[model samples]
Target: MAWRKLDKMIRPASCRAGCWRCVYGCPYGAKWTARDFIIEACRDGAHLADRARVLRVLVENGRAAGVEVEVQGKVHAVRAPVVVLAAGGLGSPRLLHASGLGPRCSPFFSDPVVAVMGSVDDIDGGAEVPMAAGLSLHEEGIALADLTLPQPMYAAFAAQVGRVDRLFAHKRTLSMMVKIRDEIGGGVGPRWADKTLADSDRKKLAHGVGMAKAILREAGAHHIFKSWHFAAHPGGSVRIGEGVDADLQTSTPGLYVCDASVIPEPWGLPPTLTLLCLGKRLGSSLAATRRAEGAA
Candidate 1:
């Protein structure tokens, strides 16, 4: 089992009991978000059109020209030599379809998760950080982790499973999550996306839940139950090789993708680091290409 901590970003002393600002928005700036990167980019001369919605990518003569954007009920075109699509897995596929680049996204995966909860006589689990420790059963396509939800969220989950009686036991509840690598079998269109779990996926989740229950029992937990299945980190819609090339470039030249949409396979784990690496690599490659053109 491996334990992850955000000690570098969050100061332990700053954390308040029952304060789950981390789940919503952190006022302390202890949580690094995409906003931080946006601020850095703006400081470095990048233009940000706040509240702008990209209508479609403009392609001319087999190359990307720019994009049409809608801002404050006004539409305008922004021209550029290179267009990078980082709208994420769901949004990227939708944009591609709107741009007439792809008819639709192929099957995709959304890591399905369920939280197993039980009552404990000691230890206030709700006060702890969620997903702090976990291990992956790669062959079984399952991952287990300690998950501590905020009281309200916990109550909601408890209520989901008709366990309203257990809602008040949030403070004494111990929770763990079972996340499964679901089979990729969903289609994404310009306006909609849907997914259904395969029998194999359900079996994997059931096995994981059984294991979690055993572990909770070992820890002296009682009144064990599970939350309904929920999904996180949807991806694999616009896959590499099928929708984009290894360089993340689409069929139209000068247009590239750098997001979860380009991930080619089912991913059951957190993708933050993988996405960061892909973004860095894409940025470097684009910068190098620009320098070459400048020199030429």
Candidate 2:
């Protein structure tokens, strides 16, 4: 009702969230993603380097001056006056730790999703986009989304069903997912994750599973199965007020860290929109800062 009152609700093409393009890369080039934005930047004269793995941020006089990256089995140093770490939550923390910037940020969380799989009579799940409709079940600390996986993925879920033929009925399958708000209990490592879900997080996930099961059953699905967990929307590593200042400046001047790494909390929502807004704000600030420095 509030969305209607504000006239802010949006119904995308096909009257759904358009999951077909999101899950699988959009062959038609219709999906809006960060790649599209980056491509536009490149067209606007921004240089893009591909496959250069940043080994560490280079610091001189306690200020970030550039980065050491490896490309094609060779190490190279890229120098710049200002260095920005736009690596995501995981990669950013790893890079910072490698550069001896800060200790690894612990108690981070990611959205872990488990899909509830079932089948309804005479329905082709692949007939339309998956997760087209969704609801925010905030009271339960979960978000509900419609789902339709490819045939092989569905088979993996039905592995214990004893009959591969029955499980192969992808068209009759009905899928939904419950994404729970997880507790922060994970630690980010330089190259690997040493994180575990908290007991509370597991309980919340179980509750979400129950909700998914109920919804599927209510929609005439039976022989319910549960898929393994997968993590998405990782954040809360180098958080605001801890790893960086509100201005996104690190202890190293002329250096900044933005992206999901600076998200202070889980948010229980997609990071795309939030990150875009943050990028815009930070871009404006950086431009202004550059202009001021030139004046000085």
Candidate 3:
């Protein structure tokens, strides 16, 4: 095989594969995180209170006035003329309900994932970052992300291999993760989320795994393995048109929502970029609203 040719295809910029640092953090300062935004906001006169968790919105005269938050084992009320709920899908709906809004939020879905694993002789799967290369089977509702998990992470997934010695061959072990677009049939409750895998979603996941396995085998991999099922990126519990308006304003005046909960449907992609774009748009609108109110 052509090692040089494969390297050009698989390598992603500056990322050394099989490093679990992305989980704890990126020490290289390559990854952008919310901390960066919070720091910039603080520099621009935004006040931040660490370890504060909001309990509910405080509504008066059918309008949002403030929020009740818990901090340091004590609950306190903070009053504001305009309140925004940036909590994610789960927390946002729960907060809306706790504030005496509708108890039922719009149904949501999650990215149901299953991974396929195999081994290839003389091929170091960990030579490059996981998911450096991918193929989108859009019509099939499946996407593949190349994976080469670190030893500990790989061992956890390959538990059925059942031998420490065999699990040590991390370099040769290759895997691909299948992220399928699941159905929206789950509700966000006050304290919990109730969701079940629909038959259609199950079929999609199975098909995605089958596609991944075929790719791995064609690349000289053998002794394929399949990991346990999992779900990620719970979203769409609230919607743009149904839960909030285009301006991100909810039915309650002065209350706004700007998060993944506002996504109208399953995007089959990571929501980080989407949320960042939404946040910027919401910030601009809020600034404009404040300016208008001040002029009035």
Clashing residue pair totals per candidate (backbone < 3 A): 0, 0, 0
Better of 1 and 3 by lDDT: 1
Scored by lDDT, the top model is 1
Candidate 3 lowest-lDDT run of ten: 1-10
lDDT of 3: 0.78
List clashing residue pairs in candidate 2.
none
Candidate 2, residues 103-132: lDDT per residue as tens digits? 865557788888887878977555455555
- Give the TM-score of each candidate: 0.92, 0.88, 0.88
Q: What is the lDDT of candidate 2?
A: 0.76
Q: Where in model 2 is the C-alpha error above 4 Å?
A: 1-21, 157-166
Better of 2 and 3 by lDDT: 3
- TM-score, cand. 2: 0.88
Give residue 177's lDDT in candidate 1 (0 to 100). Answer: 91
Ranking by TM-score: 1, 2, 3
Find the 10 residues in a row with the least total lDDT in model 1: 1-10
